[model samples]
Structure formats: structure tokens, C-alpha cells
Target chain A: MATCCGGLKLDPAVREDARRRLLSVRGHVDAVLRMLENDRVYCVDVLKQVKAVDGALAKVGNLVLQSHLKQHVVTAHERGDEDQILGELMEILKYR
Target chain B: MATCCGGLKLDPAVREDARRRLLSVRGHVDAVLRMLENDRVYCVDVLKQVKAVDGALAKVGNLVLQSHLKQHVVTAHERGDEDQILGELMEILKYR
Candidate 1:
């Protein structure tokens, strides 16, 4: 059932890294949520959170994009179905 | 030469609404940025900002998405080049 050669179990270090980064991102989310809940609108504070969230999400997004490009994109390019694959890729890009 | 009948000039209220929403979003980003700059990683505050930013972005995204669906999507569906347009649509979706 494995899609790629890499096993389902990510390396411990990688897992930890992802966890830490995810927690960091979550922390930021929490802060902003608190502000909103209290109705204490701090524009600057919210802006900072957005930036941090963006940065964190970007990192994760790049990782996913890299994998997609390396695997699916490469395969599609070689299989003569680049158009179809490219279309799919474009759709996914829209999500960002 | 206009893409749609609606003029580019959003109604004053709409314009104000967009501006207020955008500014609110920016304000959140600024707050988070300040925290990062000072190395004061307040997880709760940051989290709140992330949520607010996401909400604001989602609202804006929905507006754009509606237009894309109404304009390009409708046109594509009628043109009998569904595959091509679908592909393109998929690709654009990929960005999100």
C-alpha cells in the first residue's frame, strides 16, 4: 500500500522536527485566537501571527511541493501525460 | 474591454469593507511580526493571529473563487474544451 519507496514511518528526527515546527505554528495560532475571543483587537499582533503562520505554512508547503514535483510531476512528464498532470498541478496551485 | 459588466470600481462600501478587512488582516500580521522580532514567541497570541489571518484570507479567497467559477469556469464549460479548461482549473487550484 506504500505509494513510494520511503516507508510510512518517517525518521525519528524528521518526525520530531515536524512535530516541533507544527507545535510552534500552533502556538502562534493560539495567541491570535485568544485575542479574537477577548474582543481585544490588536492589529499589529494579528499581523505578526499571520506572517509567522505564513512562514510556517510556506515551509510545509514547499516540502509537499517538492515531493509532488519530484515524484508525480517527473512521472507525468515522462509518461506523455504532461498536460493532464500539469492541469492537476495548476488546480492544486489554486489552493495556495 | 472589461472582463465582466461590473465596473472595476467596487462600491464605496465594498471598497471600504475590503480595505477594513485587509487592514485588519495586516494588523494581525504586524503583531506577529513584532513578536518574532523580539523573540517573544507567545504561542497563544501567535495562534490567535494565525486564525484571524486565515479567516480574512479565506474570505478574500472565496470572493476570487466565486469570480473564477462564474467567469472562467462558466466559459470553459460552454466552450467544449472542458478537458483543457479543467486541466487549467486544476492547475490554478494547485496554487491554493
Candidate 2:
């Protein structure tokens, strides 16, 4: 197992939820590709589908972030890993 | 064919490029799913991968938006579609 900071693992339920959401996002991307391939698709319609995928992906990110906060961030001080946790949080924030 | 606003179609080259990028993003999402499934995955590492997918998806959106601007927005007045074009532009801006 890839030991995370503070030696805490992702909550199992959260991990499963994220995996499921990611798969749905993958399917959403496939739908957008199909729209692009069609000869008569509207630009606005394609944009809407693209936007939907974006929203879905954002949700996935939120799910992971929430899980990380609950499983790792919440317990950082007691684990004596507050500095490492803070650094990791800062790194993830850059992507947001 | 689904006629787009102003009767303009997406440029074929741009459409193909967007499709290719979307496929790559789909694969990227699959990789994230694999990471989530692994017993030892780090939350920060998983988050970084998710962020990479977000960036890639944004690039796909930009490619489509650029093509739309070039093919449709640029020629709207000449085609007497300024009002419709404006509405569509506003709608897309909400997504951004």
C-alpha cells in the first residue's frame, strides 16, 4: 500500500464513490466525442455537453477533497504531521 | 445535420483535434480510477492526477471555443446573425 502522509488511508467508502464518479465522467467524455463526430451538431450544443463534463469532473474533485479533509486533514495535529499535511493541502490548492 | 447558429459548421480540423483530446482525457480518467482502486494510493497523488484531467479538459474546451469564435463569431455580422451569436456567446460564457 502507498502510505500517505500521517499514515492515514482514504476512507474506503469515499474511494469507492470517487471511482464510480470517475467512470461516469469518462462516459460523459465519450458522449462529447460522439457529438463532435456527428456532422450536424451545433456549436452551442457541443459547448453545453463539454460544460456538463466539466461540472461532473469538478464534483469528482470535490469528493476527493472532502474525503482527504475528513480522513487526513482532520487528524493531522494529533498525528504530529501538521506541516506535511499543510504542504499537501497547499499543493492541491494550486490545482484548484 | 444539426445546423449550428449562423448556419456555420465547426472547422473539420478543429473537430478532429477536439475528439482526439477528449479520447486522451478519457484515458486519463481511467488512470485515476485505477489509482483510487489501489490499496496504497496517496490522497495528494490522487488529487494531482484529478487536477491534471481538469487541465486537459479545459484545453479541450478552449480548442472548441477558439474554433467556434473563428468559424462562427468572426463571420456573424456578415451572416446577419449578430443577435443570435450574442446570445450563444453569453450562454457559453456562463459555463466558463
Candidate 3:
């Protein structure tokens, strides 16, 4: 589903949401770093802040994965391009 | 300063810390998904969980980056391998 601006598969609402999520994560990261450097933070407190950042990252990853599955995977399956998906995912796993 | 563990520069303590951070993030991710699926969760609640996950991920990334800089980047600069470091980082950025 091409939008008026471009050929991105995600809807405008989703795109905006994703952007906001990324920005929020960036803010959280900066805040955590500042707290670590500028404040006499306890170890457990720092860990808690780190935990929050990771949770945000995971949620963003989930959202993007869901969007990809709906927009790309389903289309790929419909077109019978199972091998492409498999290869791409496998390559990414290998990167890790 | 290579350690006894096959020339890795990071101390065992750091390795353990990184592993614990990763595990904690995984737990948070699971909890968030569970809440999303099984609970009548509020949007703000879910977003907060997501934010935590992102912050955790950022912390992990920062830890790894700091360790690598102290171990690898500084060593590379000492050994006159600036080009390798630049190329590798550029390749990763290109992947994104």
C-alpha cells in the first residue's frame, strides 16, 4: 500500500508511531547516561534505568517485526517467495 | 591486556555483567508480551514497559561500546589499524 509521500508499506499512523517510539528511546538513553554521569546514582538504580531502556528497545523491535510480517512476509508468502524470507532471516542470524 | 580466556580483552566480570543484563532484558521482554496478550493492559502501561526495554538495550549497547573502545579501538589505533576500524563501522552503518 503506497502512500502519497512514498512507497513505504507502513501506514502513516504507524510510521508516526514508530518515529515517536524511537525518539522516546533516544530520550531515555540520554537521561540514563546523564543520571549515571551527573548524579550519585546507586548501582541498582542504574540497573533499573537500563532495564527500562531495554524494554523500550524490545517493544520497538516487536512493533517493527509485526509491521514487517503484515506488510512483507504475508506478501512474500502470497507470492511464494518463502526461500527469500528464509535466506534473509538466516543471514541476519548469522550476523549475530 | 589479554585475559586467560583465549585473548579476550574484557575481564570475566564484564562478560558476566553483560550476560546478566541481556538475561534481564529478555525477562522484561517476555513480561511485556505476556501483559500485552493476557492482560487488559492500558496503552500507557504498555508504553512504559516498552520504554524500559529500550533503556535496557541502550545500556547493554553502551557497555559493549565502552568495553570495545577500551579494548579494541585503542589497541587498533596503537597498532595503526585506523582503516580497519573505519571500514568495519561504516559497513555496519550501511547495513542499517
Candidate 4:
């Protein structure tokens, strides 16, 4: 969250939003853990909670990726840094 | 998944598994789209399904990151490619 968004010297607002959602997940996960509630950790309800965190993280990932594409990739492309652009594209392909 | 796992020239098995799970998401999201099921897309069941895919993708991401750490980063460090290793580390930090 920080790295992708951070790399761009992006607005702190965007970075903070990602941080907040991620922290929410961490806080919830910690609460769950503190309760020692592993009885049905893999059940639907628990899975839903897990999914909430996952979804949150994925959204953050998408934001970071979008930022990368817009700020880093496009800039590199515009500047004719073909090799770096290719490297970035190749890196993006791996996350497919 | 492919790119992250691919950069290291890992075993095809790992790559295939990531592809499979990703394809499953594609199939499912496509199926849902075909059925025009966005009316209740934000509901619990749908969110649960969304979470499943997110969870799977996160796991795949973890695998790719781990492979990169072991194969690329570790290997580079071993071979004294400190600069590349730092670049990789910095890249990984953004996905936090």
C-alpha cells in the first residue's frame, strides 16, 4: 500500500485511505485472534470476515497498481524509457 | 501471478496453479456477468464469493512473493547483486 502509492510522491490522502482500510483489517484480525476464536475459523462467517480483509487488501492492491500504471508506467512510456517501461509491464504481467 | 512467479523461472507447476485459480475467478465473474446478477451483487453471499476469490488471489500473491524472495532476491543477494536486491525489496514494500 505504502510502497506503490509512496513511490509516486502521491497525495497523502490516497495513501492514508489505504492505510486506514488495511489497519481496520489488522485491528479486526487482532481482535479475532485475541478472542482465541479458532473453533470455526474456516467456516462461512469467519471466512466472510477473512474475505473482508482480503477484499480490502485487493482494493488497495488495485489502487497501487493503478497508481503505478498512471504515474510510473505512463511517465516512463512518455519519456521513452522503453526498457524501464517494459520492465514495469513485465512486472505487472506476473501479477496476472 | 504469472509475472511475479515467472520472473524467477520457477517450476511450471507453480505457474499453472496460479493461472488456474485466476482463470477460475475469470470464469466465475464471467458467469455472474452472463447471468446479469449485479442486482444483489453487494449482498452477503455475493460478497462471500468475492471474498473467496480475493483470498485465493492473495494466497497466489503470497506464493509469487515468496518465490521472488527465495529465487530472485536471495539469489541476487548470494551473487552480490545488492542494488537489484534493494530494488526488489523496495518493490515488495509497496504491496503492503
Each model's fraction of native contacts: 0.00, 0.60, 0.07, 0.02
- Scored by lDDT, the top model is 2
Highest-TM-score candidate: 2
Task: Flag regions of model 4 displaced more than 4 Å.
Answer: A1-96, B1-8, B31-42
Give the higher-lDDT candidate: 1 or 3.
Answer: 3
Model 2, span A1-96: residue lDDT tens: 245644577778888888898889988888888888887677777777888888998898888789899888888899889898899799889737
Q: Tens digit of lDDT per residue, candidate 4, span B1-96?
A: 112222335444544554465455445444423322222121122223334556565665565456546656666756676685566557545534
Instruction: Report the candidate with higher TM-score, 2 versus 4.
Output: 2
lDDT of 1 by residue, A1-96 (tens): 112222212233333443455556556555544543333232223333445565674564454355446645677656676786577557556635
In the range B20-80, model 3's lDDT, one tens digit per residue, is 7666766665665554442223333344455566566766756755665666666766767
RMSD of 1: 15.6
Clashing pairs in 2: A2-B40, A40-B2
Per-residue C-alpha lDDT of model 2 across residues B1-96, encoded as one tens digit per residue: 245644577778888888899999999898888888887777778888888898998898888888888888888889888898889789878847
The lDDT values for all models are: 0.46, 0.82, 0.52, 0.45
TM-score of chain A of each: 0.61, 0.86, 0.74, 0.65
Query: What TM-score does each model's chain B reach against the true chain B?
Result: 0.58, 0.87, 0.75, 0.66
Ranking by lDDT: 2, 3, 1, 4
Tens digit per residue, CA lDDT, model 4, A1-96:
112321334334444554455455445444433322222121122223334456565675565455546655667656676585566456544534
Error in Å for residue A92 of model 4: 28
